[model samples]
Target chain A: MNDKVRNSLFYVGGTAVGFVSGFFGGGGGMLCVPLLQFGGLDAKRAHASALLVILPICIISAAIYIKNGYFDVTAVLCACIGVVLGGIVGATALDKLNGTAVSIIFALLMIAIGIKSVIA
Target chain B: MTPQHVIIIVSALGGVIGGMGMGGGTLLIPLLTLAAGLEQHLAQAINLIAFVPMSVVALVIHKNNGYVSIAKSAPIVGCAAIGAVCGSFLARYAGGYELRASFGAFLIALGLIQMYKAISAVVKKKKASKNKSAQIKVG
Candidate 1:
């Protein structure tokens, strides 16, 4: 594909991914990684790039949420503490772990959660 | 466990998942709403907020591992930021019930796809190993 075409595609696809992340408040990376891969990135690169893409998107969206008074301060603070720690551990493990196995399990977890959310 | 404890544990788990590049919000939102009894929108908002720090950490790690490409990521980030703003507004306007239902449906579809990918990968790995062993025996 031409540079113009690839650039346009990335922009359009990024917009879609960002919208999902903002609207749903999660799952943006799932879509973003695949989109990056389609745009010619390797899996690992896609995953890493997706994180970069999502960081700004999430920050922007979260700011909007906070401005709109849609968040819980206490919950967010506690969750942040835990998520930061987990992030360190997870990032460290990425190089050493079997990502496929972890992914499979995560996928299963997603299915279970999705079903429960729909029914409840 | 205390609510605080629950929040910490779940958030940590979500962080780990996010660090893995699977999007922590997939797991975080549900845990918050279902287990912690948070409102749907609130849970979603919290997930987004938590994502900021988590993604930064993960990105830094990936960068060190030589997995990130800034040139490629720039366009996507710029466009995604625009889309995120629009989506945030839309979510704010949409009703909670509708939002929850749609999110659930999205999760189901994504989950099934993930499962298929994982299973195929396992099968392929097994087959490759088997072929390697057969070659060794013949030699």
Candidate 2:
């Protein structure tokens, strides 16, 4: 796809994905990775983009959740710390690993989880 | 027809699905691979990015309604962040095609399982009601 087309699609798809993530708690990044990839982004780049993009969404959601009494400050803090650490580590690893292998494993895990969710 | 068109269509589609309480990853990832012709990793990454805003909105809504359950959400979010980072690193070394294929299979499997569970729950409920009715008649 041309740049213009791709860009537009990205925004549109992004909005939709955002909506879904908001409703289901699946985390929006999962959807972002695949869409960015299709939009011609490398895996690493896409991952980075996804992380950057999610920050705002997550924060907004957290705030709302907090306001409505759905957020546990303790949990959010702990989780944020863990995620920050993990994200740093992950970013470092991104340079060394095989993207395809990771994708396959990830996909398989998704399927397993999906199936379990469906069946159980 | 073009990638741009796909993006717009997909994004909007995702929003509606999200609004309806369905997970966007389920739909977005599939389209990214099949229609957009993206590697799984890229698609997933993109999905992640796109999901941020909507999730924030939802989270806020849930919090407003007092549905957050901070204690429970914390662990999950923490774990997920860690997992996401790990997954991101793995994406770097893995072949894009392989990643897409694997992720796709995983998702399909998961969806199937969830569907099965839902079905079973319904069926069980029916069976239980039937048994109860039978007992009532006997009495």
lDDT agreement with native, every candidate: 0.84, 0.49
B59: Cα error in model 1, Å: 2.1
lDDT of 1 by residue, B49-138 (tens): 877766676677789999998877887788899889999988988887787778889988998998898899899999999999999999
- Which ten residues in a row are the worst by lDDT in model 1 chain A? A86-95
Error of 2 at B70 (Å): 1.4
Candidate with best lDDT: 1
lDDT of 2 by residue, A1-120 (tens): 688886666666666445434333234665665666776666545544454445554444433333433333332333233333333344346557664444444445446544433343
lDDT of 2 by residue, B24-69 (tens): 4456655555655554444544554455555555556555655444
| Model 2: lDDT of residue A41 | 62
Off by over 4 Å in 2: A1-120, B75-79
The first chain of model 1 has a TM-score of 0.84
Specify the poorest-scoring 10-residue window by lDDT in model 1 chain B: B51-60
